[model samples]
Target chain A: TLAAPAIAQSAPELKWRLTSSFPKSLDTIFGAAEVFAKNVAEASDGKFQIQVFPAGEIVPGLQAADKVTDGTLEMAHTASYYYWGKDPTFAFATAVPFGLNSRQQNAWMYEGGGIDLMNEFYAAYNIHALPGGNTGAQMGGWFRKEIKTAADLKGVKMRIGGFGGKVIAKLGVVPQQIAGGDIYPALEKGTIDAAEWVGPYDDQKLGFNKVAPYYYYPGWWEGGPMLHFFINKAKWEGLPKNYQAIITGAAALANTDMQARYDHLNPGALKKLVADGAKLRPFSAEILEACFNAAKETYAEMNATNAAFKKVHDAVMAYRADAYLWQQVSEATFDNFMMAQQRKKAL
Target chain B: TLAAPAIAQSAPELKWRLTSSFPKSLDTIFGAAEVFAKNVAEASDGKFQIQVFPAGEIVPGLQAADKVTDGTLEMAHTASYYYWGKDPTFAFATAVPFGLNSRQQNAWMYEGGGIDLMNEFYAAYNIHALPGGNTGAQMGGWFRKEIKTAADLKGVKMRIGGFGGKVIAKLGVVPQQIAGGDIYPALEKGTIDAAEWVGPYDDQKLGFNKVAPYYYYPGWWEGGPMLHFFINKAKWEGLPKNYQAIITGAAALANTDMQARYDHLNPGALKKLVADGAKLRPFSAEILEACFNAAKETYAEMNATNAAFKKVHDAVMAYRADAYLWQQVSEATFDNFMMAQQRKKAL
Candidate 1:
């Protein structure tokens, strides 16, 4: 019932500034802020306004959350993993290796009370979190060579985020957390031999195609990556009910919009990537097995050490387990058959 | 290229009967269907094969094009609109007085598009469509209401379907065609007293809270109706895709799973509705007049001739010129904001 209430003919207008970690080129992610600003403007009939800034205009992409936490800016767009360097527990806020896909993530965060728990944790930083947008189940990083065995991973520098990197790091490879805009250069300059970003459409935009010729499938680290609109807690709580609804609505639109955009664009971009001489490769079973073991070990290690991490980790894993079981019975069975029906082209 | 040199598999999965006007459930209208049956027999290892039945089912939802097509299905899930009294496009779908709530009607329909697109449309011949979903978008049915002037809705009955029979007869209303399973019901039920469906959370489900206690936001002749999955055209192309997919996914999910099973569990369902009691009212003069002029003049005359409608009016309308575009901008923006902020309320 936050319908526009009867108000005096003239009420004071409000203004705010929001900064996002994404570049405008990635319309789905960056578009969220644009959407937020536009919604606020329309809801108040332009009486309320917000100025949007893309990443690096104010701070490094990874640093947006800190800036929001510090209130250097009233709001920001950030992924939770960038802050994992500050606290490993941050990984759960974003994603983890072999984690839940997009729908599962939304379930945990929205209906499963993950939002309340996350907010409780985020409250420590004096910020409010709204589920922003999500990039559904990303593809594995682009690599310079096909990974044949676990040995190929040894010393292979890759830019992957959150705890997935740590799990891989245990495999003796160096893990780097490079921002999206910056990944191309890191891979090009040999600062990293491989990098994983979202699906093909985004990777195509970043032109990773030119730098990393071997594109991989299934970015194990991020089954689904969620983006967040970090609003200053004080700024958020003070808004009139209508404005709150407007912001929340804007974020949800961006959530579905991005996924659709990605879905529509990825297949074509992927076809183009392969046509452009980018080699497509699948991770070998041996490598996947080792990495899975490492991820389990790392998760157990974190659960043992961090109380906050354990609570969320346990809840998410539990949900993930159920989701996995259900999907296997219902979705995966059909998918694998369809896949098996199609044979690979002879090498 | 992953393309294989065609080393013949078991002579292709062969004939199948797939019923859907959509992809699987989670997305693409009626998407869940594809997802559902796919997993079932596959887990059993392809012992069961299925043929797909899309809108038209074997034929088409709007009668003209399909004409009793698919041979296999003695059945299908579809909206009643495609038949509409075998004459009134509204009757075949669901309610047009704004009719039943998504849940109530779903109970009516599950429980069968609500019996009318069926009995009326099917009695004409060999095929039938079922009730696949109810979106819940009925408004006070989008009145020219807010109508302070006598000229408000002088003659508007709206493009109402199903429920149009009950009220339009009294109010000098001229209902039109529009589809959104959620909010179209109340509009025909005589709430804004006018309405439209298909924009924003299916309207029926959003419950028409916030903006219209007057409930006059988007009836435009829609009262949160229902969608049907059609089947026909020569016995469903002679059946084969197993016994599932077409009727399963979203039907299991969106239809039965969507507003029906979940409606009661919805957060803030009642508090929001009654606090506003949503001021359940009817379309008044003057406003209904202007809408009638716009809707009738636009359609009345058209129904008389127009080859397109001449051919299909009994079922579907000529495609609205700007439905998709208008859907993207202001419509998308306004609704999405309301959704995220509401914290899951009941319609």
Candidate 2:
């Protein structure tokens, strides 16, 4: 109780910088970091200020985790999966192929022991992790041509992200790693046949509809790709408990707000995409089944070779299995029935 | 810049109390208020302390909002829909029959204007609202017998909540308003043929499955029932901006954590119930269709007479329509396929 008196004393003003892996141009995704910083400043009465920088300003977007680890920056807002090369376990922090959706991801992280497990792994890298934002289940991609079967994937060069690319590679697709800026030209100029990005909101912004007419649903590879706010372990440890709580609270707000924005904004963008002649398509069951198998094989191979990957992968897989079971009986059934009824009315 | 020096001065200690509609036994639901209080106290270094009281501790559970409005309590952590007797508009701040699920509800409240509209309505009652918790989509209820058709509902006494009861009333069913503690006894004594509390987690704790063997799912009435933190407007306005921020952050954390806990815990709870011979069932298509129509009709009638109800209803309905459209193409399709695949593997 005596601590209350000391705590009421105004805390020291602190300033931090956050570098995001996303470009400022993609506001819905990158804007989440800004929202967190604003919340922190306001919550602390401007005492804890965090200045956010776009991808390349402080460090290259892909190098955000390293810089934070090295304490070059106090924090970084980026997708953990972006650092697949550092350790495959990083993918588990963000999204792996056939990973948890946004709701399920939150459940796994907050309640199903995922945050603790991931944090234990993160401790080795001198980082502390917090869920920052999420792009709800993304779209499959914009494809230059229709993909009807597993055979359709042969020789197709797709600009896909890390773990997902590895999965599809087994289907005879040539997985091409390319930066965001180069994806459109590659798709348009026939250098790549397909490209996967976030969802309707970000994809529409990138003008993917013009370059590729076949818009796909259910980015199965990323059921829900979560972004993280990585704090330098030493810096986080040094903060007063109040400041830590403020940071925790701000990150939680940003996490929920990002998804709300996407859910609200993507509908309008999808409407525009369809109106502009982009054909929306669902990946064939055959193709999806094949990809699922390949994802399993990819995981098995990695589990065999990488101890860290196996640890995180095992935890995520166990949590996801239970989540999927629960969702099937509740969310999945309700949605299926409701959507069917909705389509009937439309017809 | 000069304000920084003044803010550093110690703030006066403040203590508040929150009354919850739930009992302490139901940890996840009632526990959210406790979580919020703990976070606030910790973040404020014990300066701003909130003591949580369970329902009936200070006042009857249903009276939480009125008590907060009159400032008998500083706040109440309860579902806004509990005050449906005050005005049907109250349900929009919570959940309406056949309305948005958890994710969509968050989208509507945070992004599609539900929060602002609901808060405007709440202001008239001298309360300010913040989303505090959620129990994802609930089960329909525990039923002693099969409800295979709309006719099956006739003459059935069901212990249901506010707005949902009104919608289902058209099917010749007798809708009984009973407190959570009394539901099990009523079901056991045959006073009510069916009853709904929350999902598998809470229902199992209440021993509903023992009396009612048929456990129906997808509580259509409460697709995503959200709880609210109702602060006395005057009390809220008197707080420092920093204190308000702490409250906001704490409530957001509780809101997300409540659902995560339910989602994580429910799967295991459900498995245990089924193992104990509780039969899991889905409401039939014909019955669901009839209920949907009844719900729409009920809303229409309310809109015709209730101005406040009309305002919130209009906003929520508009947002939900857009959400449904987007979800069908994305969440619905993906979940349906994924669940089917999951079921196949299980088989």
Candidate 3:
């Protein structure tokens, strides 16, 4: 028989609890938490295990980060923007209106000093954050009526999440914050004129096409929203170095897997939604431009008031400028060409 | 002192070697192999150690896979397309002319049953493969002179890499497979009229711009190329399940890290290249169309002759058609809006 590795002899068993901000029904997002947990357990040979719980099981979805920070839980898998109400700086960890897309978000976090900057802010809350998942660029929303111009947004009550609502409010839109489950009812009963909830995969699950006829492209505010694994600072520091490495690797794996899942599933869900009479419309340039200016103004206000927000925001904006410049030259060009080929049935 | 865990007490010590297809000078690609090894070792508490070697340490760059296949090396890090001569089906594992982009490729691999399909094919070669790294959309090679149309490519000798050469050869261009280190001198002496490498970051390191002033936009042939970690089948099966899981997670981490590094670094390098007199040009639509048609012909021929190639190619093509249709809807629209803002200096 082969001799066992010496380091393995000293490994300690640990069990952790991870609270997810999403329900199990939203598998892509919630599934990432499960994926991370499974990877950690498998890699550790079941010596380290994480038990996951859906939102509201322990605390409300919006309170996940608070639980982690207060040590009520060892960790929480949630979007950082969900805590923007605590401090606007939290929004940068996930996304901001007109911010980086999925690829750019990963680049910024891993290479452009984003994780270090965000962690510096997160440390203040007694938490440490690692990117766990991303939704890629999202759909604008399902709307009962066409929104052709900035003026069309006036007085519209839309169930938009996080910092996006604040930006849109500048255009005279009424922004309502509602839970995912409540969104369909709100739109169906005419309580809300529009609601944005991820992209085709998740949106289709809520049967948004049944409630709203017109669907819009590009959720500009949450272009590439990232979900994070927030660990209690003390708990995170106490981990064995091996466990820390395993968790980090597992988190990164889950992060990539989530986006891949979204990318693969969205195409088919979109085809189904369209087949079910959901009308797809691009957010007109006029509307996008208007929102862009609104987002800029919102950022300016936060930058003046919040030092942490200012520090991270400035770095992201600088990187964003350069990222888009390079992206347009290669990635966008290739994508555009391929898209044209698809449209022409050349593929 | 507390008692050590049962699993740790029984862990076995193991050391392995990884040979990379990349030279150490190209850190981003070669660095991924180092990253994977480091993650694996750290996660295993140093019980499982994998020493890494750049190309030529254990075997030549292109022969890394063969060494693993014959059990001469425990594993190898290489691009699957580099082994296309062994089997055309191998190209689907890395990339093909006018194939999927980075995000799309990840989607196909992780969520679209791509790994299972490729592994089935690799089983014949006595290997088990995992995605290790990706070079997003690559830049079209540096050129001594501009190539405006397909007509300009006639009789041109280009130092193009694997599989892409076969597709472009249909257009009367002679494709030369020169090693990366030799491409510069070959281009300088006019031994090759043009040579394509990776994007701005790697290309800048090689000083391609100094010899070839005309830098091209998209390398349609090698868009979103993936590199693989090829483990000897017998060695992989002999590992404990814990090590297998750890290796899988580490590879995924390195895979995401490589692309993030490229995306973050490319922008600055591109700026430097342009400032240092690299004239950037887009391949003309006429040329792109011609190349796309040629790629289609090449794929079709392979599909008809090779059953393994047909199985994977058909699935990829089916997914590609849908991926683009959905991408154009949300991702492209959002990107176009941002790029336009960047151009107008409104961002």
Candidate 4:
């Protein structure tokens, strides 16, 4: 409240730089970061300007967690989970497989004490995190061959991204970590059998359907994968509180914009994939079951081994159980009958 | 563009009634409608007021279409697809399973001639449709038991709302059409074996998970279910053009608010559901395949039987194809890797 008087004295000018883990071509997610920058400048009456750079312009995409911690860049947008390499506990900042979807993920981060919890982890890294954007639940991977059994996953060379690779590797999968621009070529050259992308729209554009005929459903790994704008802790602390509020508010707007972009574009894209000889496939029960088990084992191991991962994982799993039960009575009944009738000849 | 100057003119005084398809307790969707009403009042210096009533207060939820059509109410917020029962062709006004998601839906409706095309159909019914809100691609419903094969669907009594019921019925589902308030009693009494509803948060509040043990994924029927505010066609036309613009702008604001509410509340609700012993299941391949085939047949039949269905369906389909392809390339690849990484322990 005291700052309000000071703020009224005069709006100050500020300048900053932002780097994104995505290219400008992947407009929705990348565009959120871009828009966040623009909002900063506009909302400040042109007093605040933020210049943005795509991944690799200044650092490797995966290295953003550290670069921001070191203040190499003023800010950056990347998945908090990407920093799992730095600390497994960082996954809490993004999402976990079979975890929360976009709505729940947002709640946890914003209101569910999740922000403070994750901040503890970030404190150690000398970085701060704000939710930049989220993709609602995603689809499984696009594969060259249909997975019929758990055995089918063994020895598979796939461009599986990030942490889910560790779980899948337990089933004998050889996980390949590649950037967005490189995935298609890898699949095309038979270097990888398949890859998982966001959903229909993005996948179709990359022409993954041509290279991988089989498309799967339910992006279990990312029920709601969240992206974050990371700031050096010292840099964040340096800003006038109003400017900080503006930045945080701008990130929320970008979050909304990012999801809006994907939702608007995904439906039509899925249809195109099917039309283009892309065979949509659900992962076989056996394979899914195996993956689920692997994920559980992985979770238990981490909980027992790492205190931070144990703390966050316990918190999230507790949250999920409570949420799932209440939906069965009201929401489920209404939706089931409605969906069941959707395809009917209107009475 | 020529109307830009006119739209900038001051909004005037008005009072109205808005009948909603949702309960007041379901704050998010209902809240959006309320926000629109409130914004109108404030913008017009308290000259405009809108009072919202839950469905069944003045009329049954499904009858909202007819009520607004006949000018029985000033306005109503529901889905155009809900009226597919009156005109099978109305399905195009909403989403079909695996159809356009939110982003594309907004684009088509606002920019791609979709609103014009939809109004052409709505004109016959004497209602003008405005974008009320959208629940970006929703989760599939929850079930009372695990379904491993298509056989489980035989004689399964379920609450499936909207046009989606038409396709699922082919799999031997005994679909029930009921209002939101009535679903719980029916499900609780064992009147239905399964149900589908909007995902997590709302579902949790509804307490569906208490009754249904098996929660399913991929609500194919409603990839991007959009709600519309229906005004009597004559009533709409009678408004000053500026008033009309205000309504549309306000409706857009409401749309965003509803989505934000859902995003914020869903996670903790889902956490609660799982803790209560609810089971999560994926609809078996056979059932999904069956539904897909039936949807195709339904489309074909409608095209052959009705000219309007054929016209709008053809146009939207073509648009969807192009949209899907573009997103697949850009959004999908980045998401896959990011999601997988989110699930891992730090490297």
What is the C-alpha lDDT profile of model 1 across B200-298, one tens digit per residue?
A: 223335455444455443242443366654556334334332222222222333343233222222223333444555553434435444543444454
Candidate 4 local Cα displacement, residue B37, angstroms: 14
Q: How well is candidate 3 docked (DockQ)?
A: 0.83
CAPRI band for model 4:
incorrect
Candidate 2 ranges with C-alpha deviation above 4 Å: A1-10, A345-347, B1-5, B8-10
DockQ of each: 0.02, 0.61, 0.83, 0.09
lDDT of each: 0.53, 0.85, 0.91, 0.71
Question: Quality of candidate 2's docking, in CAPRI categories?
Answer: medium
Q: Please write out the lDDT profile of model 4 over residues B1-347, one tens digit for every residue.
A: 56324322423346788898877877777777787777555433344577888878988777888888788898998878877877777877778865776656766776577888999888998988877677755766767777888877889888897667778887788888776667777788888887777777677777888777787866778766778888889988887653564465456556655655564566556667788876766565566667777787888888899998899988877766655544443333323332343444211
Tens digits of per-residue lDDT for model 2 on A174-230? 988888888988988999999998888888878888989998878888888888999
Q: Give the top-scoring candidate (lDDT).
A: 3
Clashes of 1: 163
Please provide, for model 2 over B1-347, each residue's C-alpha lDDT reduced to its tens digit, 9 standing for 90 to 100.
Answer: 56534554434488898999888999998989998998888777677899999999999889999999999999999999889988888888788888888988888887787778888999989999999888888888999998888999999999987988888899988899887778888999998999988888888888888899998877888888899999999999998887888888888888888988998899899889899889988888888888888988898899999988888887777777667778887666666666676667621
lDDT of 3 by residue, A118-185 (tens): 99999999999999999999999999999999999999999997799999999999999888889999
Residue pairs in candidate 3 whose N, alpha carbon or C atoms collide under 3 angstroms? A4-B11, A4-B12, A5-B11, A5-B12, A5-B13, A8-B8, A9-B8, A9-B9, B141-B196
Off by over 4 Å in 3: A1-10, B1-10
User: What is the Cα-based TM-score of model 3?
Assistant: 0.98
**How many angstroms is residue B272 displaced in model 2 relative to the true structure, after the best TM-score fit?**
0.2
